[model samples]
Target chain A: MAVLNEKMIENTSLNRKDILWMKIIKQRQLLVLCVPFMIFVLIFNYFPIWGWIMAFQKFVPGKGIFGSEFVGLANFKEAFTDANFINAIRNTLLTSVLKISTSFVSAILLALMLNEVRARLFKRIVQTISYLPYFISWVVAVSIVYMALSPSSGIVNEMLVAMGIIKSPIAFLGEGKYFYGVVAFSNVWKNVGWNAIIYLAAMTGIDPEIYESAIMDGAGRIRRILSVTLPSIMPTIKLMLILNLGNLMNVGFEQVYLLSNPSNIDASRTIDVYIYTYALRSGRLSYGTAIGIFNSTVAITLINICNYISKKIDGYGIF
Target chain B: MEKKRSHDMLSKIGYRRMTAEDLFLDLFIYISLLSLCVITLYPFINTIAYSFNDAIDSVSGGIYLWPREFTLRNYEKILVGNKAISQALFISISRTITGGVLGVFATLCVAYVLSRRDFVFRKVFTPFLVFTMYFSGGLIPTFILMRDLHLINTFWVYILPTMVGAYNIMFMRSYIEGIPDSFTEAAKIDGASEYRILFTIIFPLSLPVVATITLFVAVHQWNAWFDTMIYNGMNPKLSTLQYELQKLLTSALSIAATDTDATLASGDSQKAAVTPMSIRTAMTVISVTPILFVYPFLQKYFIKGLTLGGVKG
Candidate 1:
């Protein structure tokens, strides 16, 4: 890292205007190396930002962005009034907030528990199993949740019935009331271990001497953890919390889309799914574009707000 | 030695002696971790059990912990002579391999260039990459861009748009930056070109991060279904296993909900024996099996790589 920074200084020392041409000629290989990536980024990443102009247009498929009629916030007005759009925002926020809290708490607890374990092999084994679901796609994760909660052949329903917890099988997936909890729990189950890894890493960063000092002061295991470990990792915890809260608008479209059916659509619709439904399926391109812009704006605002709050509360933030 | 003193201290503190409070804490930790392990694993186990159980008997629903009436019929139907499933699987596997290789190469190229100390473009391009992480053009415009590029519904659609991820490029660049400049500087002094230095020297040293990122890209490509659903849903030949599996499950559920009684009462023995429940479970097992198989072995490297990102952040 130091070498590269030093090299940058050495090469930039040529103040003479004539030497600039020679420097460019000498660095031809590096220039050649950068062209392909620059072209790809320009096309794929930057081009889309230019495409956002469609949000202001009465876009037609063949008319192109240049030919499309400039409507000027008409699409945004429509999106704000649309019931489906409003419902999507509500559901997206509700699900994101629920998932963020549950997963955060579980991950912290899991990390703390893992830290207390004395056996190395046991810790490794536990970690391996915990992160297994992280590798599986939402398609697979939703299917597992689906099969387990199936009203007919599902083991969960069967166990509940046997234990007299319910009079009969409940269609857990079919009910709107249970949708938030189901989505939140399933998201936590899949990501808890993966999230725990960050906390675990943060725990390792805490000085061992602090723990020894606490032990000398006759602090018990739990006491030491409370007094030393938690406070030491508080900065990481705050950073992660702020980062996650910043992404509160993204409720993971795949989970809701896959798990949703006619019975659960009312509860499951989110901004991403709503965009796909309207823009791609119905071809209401301009309205979807407006809503998409709205979604991203809200997310960026939330991130900035959260980062500011974190900076004030703690001394650090992602920015 | 420090270790010996720690060991002595451990014994002195009753860590080895096991006081009642220590014993209680130990027991509590073990039980909690073991239960967590069970909870994490039970869903997979149950899916396997359902896949193996007799479809007809599974509906009565006493099957727990293991299959009651074992059968390979589910596997046979899925694995043998089913053109749709076979095609989807083939497409998925091929795309994962092709996309993984191309993605890694593209990411490595861009990251390597940006990692260069004296590259004038680095200052200009770095912000271009970082800006995308915080904000984007969003769904519709990106879709339109793809349409304009004629990438929609084509095989290139799957591999091209995602070929260079901003996050991956940043991580890879940072990893490369950590490589001492002396190595590349000495090679440059020996008349080595940038490409030669990258491939011969830097690439070999970067195997760990490279492997980690490659596996990540492979897993992502393998599991990806959203793009397939959106861009290429009309093209069956381009369908991935995940997309197919999703279709299979939803269709199966709707069919079961509407025709459960009709199908059962018709008394057609073979159809009755292999219910939609069994087929869905079987498909779930088949699709996830590869990830489950490879995950345990590669988990250590993955954990290290992920934690590296966490700590760096």
Candidate 2:
């Protein structure tokens, strides 16, 4: 009886295996479609994680990752002690804070102003023109900024001098004091229109009856906006804020890199640019990898913390 | 009649008579908006004016909305007089088209597979793909991987790393899932394979999203100079228009700095035959013209795409 029971159990397990195999065979076309992408993702996305091991090693290009000496947390220690890295962290946080706050407020304000516009053609034209900068490359945008701020010939300087706002043209990009402000202003100029789309979308979902009731209550346009529209879009505002806060670490490598000249290099070198300058440019591969790891860790932790807070408040997380 | 109805509706909604305060508010809002438009547009107009002004003449400053010394010389120098600019332009266009096409097709394939609710592995693959959106292996690792794959300094470096984006895939999948399953079900019932349904039915249906993704990827590729700077910095043959523009801008700024210093020393200003300002402005125009050409289509679809993604988020 025991032998018969054991054989029957074995036969049932084999039958379950057969079922799974049959399902895979029947869905072979789908499998064929998926496997290549899976492989691509594995190679491009997953395989890079293997290189993170270098963060713990004294990695050398000649010897490669495998032959590199095992240094453990020394590289990470070096990163923490490095003055440039610390300064980079400060710049990254400072610029990111400035950028996030300014862009957020400007985008919302622009949307509110746009929502108040009565002329559809005027609104459409303004919106279209605003989005123009967002689409162009930072290279082109920076070039435009350079020309517009050029002390010798830029319209900005010319206008300022003409208006007697200053005795002479100021080199906005040539000073460290103006770096963060210029970065923040340029960010708002590029993204304010694009960013406003979300708030505008949130506003569209506001019930018209709410506005009608406010108007009936003797609410002026400003009061109606303050009470009806703002409250209605509060959730969206929170979500956008949380999302932006989550990305506090990534202060846009390309924008800062392009904007940095020798004059502003001290203020503009964020962690991302630091990694590039050290690892790729100067060939300190392992130390760069260590800093990169630190940056990623902080970013992921921030995202999770934000995600948790969002879930607590909204009952749904971004994930 | 329509205007009358709208007026009636407005009144019914308690539209008050325009008080002096209301008129003042209206004027404030309109003027603010008008100024915003000017601030946004004045830069481009100024750049265009500089590009068209004579090279030496632009050095004297004060060109605002229109060219003071109207000449085609700047455009001529960029479009015809220079070999490097043309080569960079060619490379930029080629990469944009190739990368855009391949990226769309790859994203669609992955999206279609994940959109299939009946597919047994959809649950597994969806999360696996979406996780990539939140985390990455960072820069150095990605650069090392490119080197290992022999993609460094090659044109393929531009195409491959960006071929399959998680955000685009998710966007495409959400769009694909919106299409009724009945169509694909009917195709399957007719003994049509998944490939057939994807090509004959899904691709045609997903053209709007396709155009949207194509624009996103193409613009990204066109605007990308960092990749060229990192991966192909050594190879002039593979230099993109944006990268070339970057090179030009750097040299121009340095030269302008020294030129000013020289003037300061001598207490007299001298104009070069062709200033770095003119070349930089001309290159800027050349790079931006293609984007402006496609701006209308971009404006139409990108808003739709943004709202769609916004809803999903």
Candidate 3:
């Protein structure tokens, strides 16, 4: 709870210097270092901000930002009433819960298993192979999943058929019912290993002395893990959960966009996809921005709320 | 006599150290880890094999953990059919290396500046940068701004828009400030210019976080496709590897999945099909090759760099 910079931190105490070069130099090096960052910020970040007014106006490219007619909050009101907006919100919240839970459980289970392995060589190979899928682009990853799940001749359907389970192959990606499942499962497969990396990183930091002490007390492996390993990684677990909850709205557009079909659109249209469709297809820039602004506002507010609660409850958050 | 006695003692200790229960725990751990690895690695290996195996073999449910026909035709499909992807690879590679290297340099400079308490604007700049993270002009505004600047479909759009990010800057800053100030003062007193001090002293010492951010930015640039899709639409040449890979997925698979023509001819030796599964797999391999290659150099950072400048949990 202590404020690291509480005193308004006069922020000084550099060594005194000569008159000729150092007089004018008042840390000129610092200024020089900052110039490029300043330029990047101004051009990419700040300039684009001026276009926020497009949300208010009709947003004609020919009319320009300044020249457009002010429609006020009409775009927002329309977005509010839209069925697609409602569905998008519901879909976003639902899928995000599925995604985070699936990923969180699988990664922890994986880390627990990985930690207990005694054969160092086998453990290393397993860890490396598991994490390989993490590095591939989601765009490409969707393809792999699509191929494996395709209705006519996918390995999954083939195995199911060979086992005489189903009379017909299920169109896993094409229909409304199965699309969400596929999305969440694909997320788990791609991220579980990568997510385990953090927990693994956290676990290695646990003191070896604890294990020795646990052994002395006749504590077994599971007991030692539950008592020592789990507790040690709890801080990371809490921090990551809070951060995940905050950014829960941001389902990647690439995956849904690539995988979704007209039949599955009703199920898979998250907020990002909704806004993308509105903007790209309808050319309703104002309406799209209104939706984007609404989505982002919720995202930002949630993140802040998470940060505040994390700090208040556990005394940890990424400030 | 002492050695024989010690061996007896070690055997006694070993006998006492582990029981059937301990062996069960070890066995359980090994089983779980192995299963987890299979679940994780299966899809990746399947795709890799599918890319090499004939498209017919793959689509027909033959390809799984290993290749069937062992043909390079899928790789050939991508390189031969699309000149756009080939061009995009060169562009992305140059941008990643140059942009990545320059990003590190610029980040180092800013981080150093921010690290110094003497820098008056350090406090002023910190939140200003962080503010952008939480809020941005939505896609429309950003697109309009890009159009206004005429950065659309240009090489500069790829490089300049995300040249230096605030978190990365903060990461480097926190790291640089963690270094002792005395080193910088000592270098300064020896009449080393600021640039010289940076290159010689600060950079060498700051390698851990620098390496960390380098991987972050490089991977980010490599994985980026949304920007290409939105900003450089219709410009096939500007399509990054990710973009090209996406096109292969959607255009090839999404469209082909529906058309009965491909399905009807599915059994044929028809080169007419162009093999959606194979192309997708091939593009996946191609897109991932750079990450796999650079991975060896940067993999150490996954643990070392992360923990060294680790944020307080």
Candidate 4:
């Protein structure tokens, strides 16, 4: 009987191919609709990926990826050995870690606080106001930061002097030590509310009876939140954390670029910035591609590892 | 045990009532929220204040919350001072609308096709879309490709290369999946073509996601300067508002670095009266005002879209 079923399936698949062609003919317009998009994806996405071969080659302008010398792992080795490359990687990781932790905490706290708000109007207004910065461009945002922290003419310096907190203005952007903190804080301020939306959504899904029961058990609002709300949202928290862990290397290019200058280059030169400088600015195409290859490889590996761990822990993975 | 029992009894009596603890908590929450609101709005307020103040007076500093010596000259300069400013504004607006509409349409096409469960080619194409999200050719090769394609230094490069976003396509696909298969199946039985069913049915049902992606794309286009910086490459005609703003700030910084105020003067005496700081503030205001204007009405949709992605995605 099993042999007969297998034979029938094989026969059906043969027929299925004919049916598929029929369906294609029927849905010919849909295929036409998808054609332009497919071409776009190919040119914009796949073409670039195919060009990654330049990372392995001594790529010259006229030679193209095909005609270039395939020195094989030499560029990768060169990238790994460079002090600037290592610094970029280090800076990327440091800022990413700082940003992830700070934003994660801020989002959680804000979401919790928002959840505690009794007045609907107040919560909505606060939430609305907070998301404004998220929509503002980093160019504008960086300008705001620069103006606010400008040594000679900044509001911060003025206020500090008025309050006698300091006799002189401190060059916030000119220092290396403050760069990570500044980037992290600015990032948190911009994204905290937006990030909190996910947590708030998860909170809304928590069963109301759990909170009722906690209250019945004489737990205060804080205690109820701790025992009921936090526990219920642990999966979401874990999910977001793992997702963020995957992006540990992408310390947002725009923010770093806009904020970075010669003074803060020591702390601000992330991998993306480094690649941009080499590849586009200096026109060291092959060397930059090699660094990009390194950056992407590490990022993909981190994501996979995080996905693996997430699955192991919770039977759920992004992939 | 007795104390616990008494506490439970007391709590049960006042479960609906605000206790002293609740009162304190409410106070803390309100104070914290208000403070946060102030902090969030302070820089924006400061920018506005600086934008209106006299340029030279602003250089003396200490304009914190409001314009000290109020004037409309800075805005006048931005509006009528330079043709590039208005030109950049037009470019920014045009690109935002054009890019947003086309981007959404292109993304939706990929998403709708991929959403079809019976499409035999979906397995092949879905991975093609998803693979791009994780890996890319990197900067130089892609730039080289754009340069080779002659897409460099053109407006098409802005819209075409970014026409489709992989994550957005996936998000839309996930959204479309939530739409019942029965509707499409019924349409199929009625002899409605796939495109007909998609346009007539799926498109209407997927408005929330569509609106979400539109806002996302529009905001991105509006905020974009890096592309202009790279692709446009000092082509003043193609520069967007944000790019022009960056240039203004950069030039101002460079000037501030070398000369104090004498050589900073431009041919336009009106603009020269407004210090670079004030001019920059005005430019910042110009850059942000449009987003701020439209944000309130669109805020709910963005929040909804995010939660939709969070839950289903």
Candidate 5:
């Protein structure tokens, strides 16, 4: 009786394995469709992780990644102690904070103002014009910025001088003192309309009956906006805040790289620009990789923290 | 009944006389919004005016909404005199078209496969792709990988790494999932293969999403200069328009920073007709014109796409 029971158990286990294999065979076409892309993802996304090991080694270009000397934490040590890297970190955090706050507040304000507009044609025109800058390349946008900020011929300096606000024209992009403001202003200018779209969508989902009840309670326009509109879009506001927080380390590499010069390098060099300069330009491969690792680590940690907070508050996370 | 009630409420609200406070608020909103429009538009208008004005004449610096001395020399200099700019334009156009098409197709295939509930690997592949959205191998490793693959200084660098994005895939998959399974099942019963169903049915039905993704991918490819700056900087033959503009702008900016007087006074007598400022403005206009042309028609679609992604995300 014991032997019979054991044989039956073995037979059932083998049958289960056979059924699994048969199911895979039945979906062979689907496998063929998916496996190539899986391989593509592995090559482009996952395979490069093996090269991250070079951060530990003193990477020599001609010698290849495998043929490098393994130095323990030396590259990271060099990075943390370097003054420029430290400055880059400071600039990165400061600029990111400025950008997040300015862009966030302006977008919400623009959306609220637009929501109050009763004229459809005027609203559409303003919205369309506002989105134009967002679509253009930063190269082109920077060109416009340079032209507008030029001390000699720029419209901004011209207007200021015309108003007798200053004795001489100021080179807005030529000083470190104005770099953060310029970055933040240009960021808000470019993205305010595009960013407001999400908020506007959220506002549309608000119930009209709530507004009616508020009106019945003798609520004024300001009171209606404050109590009804703001609270209604609270979830969206939270989601956007969390999303922005996750990207606190990424301070627009293209904008900073284009904007940075000898004068403003003190304020403009973020970690991305720093990594590019060291890793690719100067060919400090291992050290650059170590810095890159530092950036990715912080970014991932921020994202995970934000995700955790979001899940705790909203019962859902972006990931 | 609901519509009638809302209409009645709106009418009642409309009947209420505008209070002085409401009038003041309305005026404030309108004035602020109009000024915002002016601020957004003034830079582009100034650029256009400068591009049209003669290089030397623009140096006097009173041009605002209109060109002080109009000429076509800046445009002629860029289009006819410069061989590099024209070649870069060609490279930019080709890459935008190729990248846009391939990106959309790859995104569709992945989304379709993932959308299939019965596909055994759907559970595995979805997470595999989505995990990339949160983390990456960072810049150095990716650069080394591209170098090893011999993609440096090649056109393929622009297309391959960006062809299939996790976000695009997720967006497209959610879109495809909205299609009824009955359609695919019926096609299967009629002996249609997966490819046939995708092309004949899914492709036709998913045109809106396809258009949205195509515009997104194309704009990204068009605007991308960093890739060219990094991977193909040495090869002028593969330089993109945006990168060319970047090179011009950087040189102009550096020169402007060091010697403001030299830039205004540096143009030679023979080619003094074209200055760095004029050429820069002309290039900016050229680069931005294509986007402006398509912006109005495609604006609604992208707004919808963003809202959809935001909701699902």
Candidate 6:
């Protein structure tokens, strides 16, 4: 680590600016500072890069990525044809879309509703409590889900029965059809409050005078909110949307991994889980890498396209 | 107009206060808010109850509000079985603490350097870090990298891989930016080395974000079972509590949850079988309690850390 830092400054001096080497040497102090972090990124982030080559090779455990014989395009071919791989790509896209939309709309609606609170003390309490679930790990959160949706004795089923919806219980975790909805709803529930945190910060940036002036003009609360509040937070919303678009193919691996079952296999097979199954679980190194590469390619393209479109439409991009 | 307005206000204050408009809105808001709060907290509460309840109650019927049949037997069962749980806890806690410390220090160092206005290479390295955030070496190479470094099944593998967080580094750097650079420059004039300037001056001033990042990293370590799942999945002893419980409970939920005594080896040939529900419940409570205890203490600083970090980083 020290070696890495020293190297950043050894060639550059603190006084020189014209030479790139001198610039580094000149800020030898700061360059030295970047050493440990750079080494870490090198060791952790860069080291694994060799594995991407595995996508083109036929990787075996003992032989590893380097030792494995190159089997060009075989894994990619397999991934394209493999129903599981194709389904995973589709499901991942679907879930990310659902989460982005639900989280976007719900968080705004929830925040708007929250802003109406006259009681400061009450609003603070509500804000804190709502954000608590986002902290729980998937393992803990899923258990709560299991308890709430347990077929014979889940609280949700119990309530549904009491309300005369169904005489029998619905097996939430045991079905394939409800998998998307379950993943989407649980994700929205976990994230809506947390994601709203950003918008809330943005909302504070809105001028109070806008609201006051609207009231002065005898505009009702609804009209002022539609015209002013939404317009003010539009930049934040668009920025968030673009960022969300960037990870369109990377819906979570943990929660879906936790909730997935043989029965729900059709609905819950996302690319992350699929990658885990192939690379981590089954030890199909090349195949997993190929799938991951494909997924990321699609995600990156989608993000770039979205960024361009948004830049054209609204002249804003996170980049 | 002033007299009429004052009289209107006087009349409004006569009862409890308000023109009846504020009162109903307050009730509507409070009720709506209370229900949402219930939705938020209800799941966490149920899991706690499930952890403590008897094994049979978990699978048999519904349990809400409280355990169907209270029992400490399940906890005993898991404890008595594979001494792996105890070892996993110790391993995970130490790994997180040690790893978190190193990651924070390294990240702070990088962030500090980048925060300097005079650093020319900051721009060069900034994009490098962001680029890595967007892309990762596919799994095959990463595994190979770990293998080459002899990181397999070693503690350094965990600590070293996480030694830098560009996101956190960005946050810390931006935060350090807020600190006046004159202090560091003055320290330099006083003949303090760069190391001293970092430790004595910059680090002390960075307590708030540092504390917040600590919570973030610590929580990350606690919540993350994936590392253990990937690196040491085969080594049951090295598996953290979260991963161990996840594996055992998810596969054979009841088998891991049953009481040891209930399934105790008989004088003959019979062996033990864990009761699934109780064991899962016990594991959930055990794993989550320490972290949950930690949240409220760091809540204030941690909350600010995320929002502020998000904006600047």
Best by DockQ: 5
Ranking by TM-score: 5, 2, 1, 4, 3, 6
Off by over 4 Å in 3: A1-25, A162-167, B1-21, B56-59, B252-261, B264-273, B309-311
lDDT of 2 by residue, B1-313 (tens): 6544553565445435666756777788899889889989888988998888877667677788899988887778777878877888899999999999999888999899888887878888888888888788989999899999999989999998878899999998888999988777888889998889999999999988888898889999999998999999998899999999898776555443234422432443343245667778888888888888787666767787778777777
Please report, in order, the local distance difference test score of every candidate based on alpha carbons.
Answer: 0.83, 0.85, 0.76, 0.84, 0.87, 0.74
Once fitted onto the true fold, the runs of candidate 2 whose alpha carbons sit more than 4 angstroms away are: A1-16, B1-16, B253-272
Deviation in angstroms for B224 in model 5? Answer: 0.6
Docking level for model 5: medium
The candidate maximizing lDDT is 5
Candidate 6 per-residue lDDT, tens place, A1-319, comes to 9998887786465434447676666667766777756877988897676568888987787886567799889888887789887788778888888877888888887777676664568877888877777776787777667657766556888899999999887887777777788888888778777777777776666666566667557555566668888899887777778778888877878998888877677778888887776666777777888887887688778778877977886776545
Q: Lowest summed lDDT over 10 consecutive residues: which window, candidate 2 chain A?
A: A204-213
Clash pairs detected, candidate 3:
none
Residue-wise C-alpha lDDT for candidate 3, range A123-204, written one tens digit per residue:
7788777767777777867877877787765777787888999888877877778877888899888878778877887777
Any runs in candidate 4 off by more than 4 Å, and if so which?
A: A1-16, A161-167, B1-17, B181-186, B251-272
Candidate 2: RMSD over Cα atoms? 3.0
Candidate 1: deviation at residue A139, Å? Answer: 0.4
In the range A1-319, model 2's lDDT, one tens digit per residue, is: 9999999999999999998889889989888877887788888988888999999998987788989999989999998889999999999999999999999999999999898876779999999988889889999998888787777777777788999999888888787788899899989888898999988888877667676677668887778778988998898899999999999999998888778877777898899989987677898888988898899899999999999999999999999
- Point out the worst 10-residue segment of candidate 1 chain B by lDDT: B253-262
Off by over 4 Å in 1: A1-22, A309-319, B1-17, B253-273
Q: Give per-residue CA lDDT, model 1, range A189-241, as digits (tens).
A: 89899999989988877656667777778877778778988998888888898
What does the lDDT come to for candidate 6? 0.74
Q: What is the lDDT of residue B159 in candidate 5?
A: 95
Q: Model 3: per-residue lDDT, tens digit, B1-313?
A: 6543543553354347787876787778777776777766676777788778876655556557889778887787678877877787877787788779877777788777777776667778887887877667777778888888999988778778788788788777777878898888987888887788888999999887888889888887888888888888678777788887777666645453453324644766766344655666778888888777776566666656555444444
Worst 10 residues of 6 chain B by lDDT: B253-262
- DockQ of each candidate relative to the true complex: 0.59, 0.56, 0.43, 0.47, 0.65, 0.37
TM-score of chain B of each: 0.89, 0.89, 0.85, 0.86, 0.93, 0.82
Model 4 has a DockQ score of 0.47
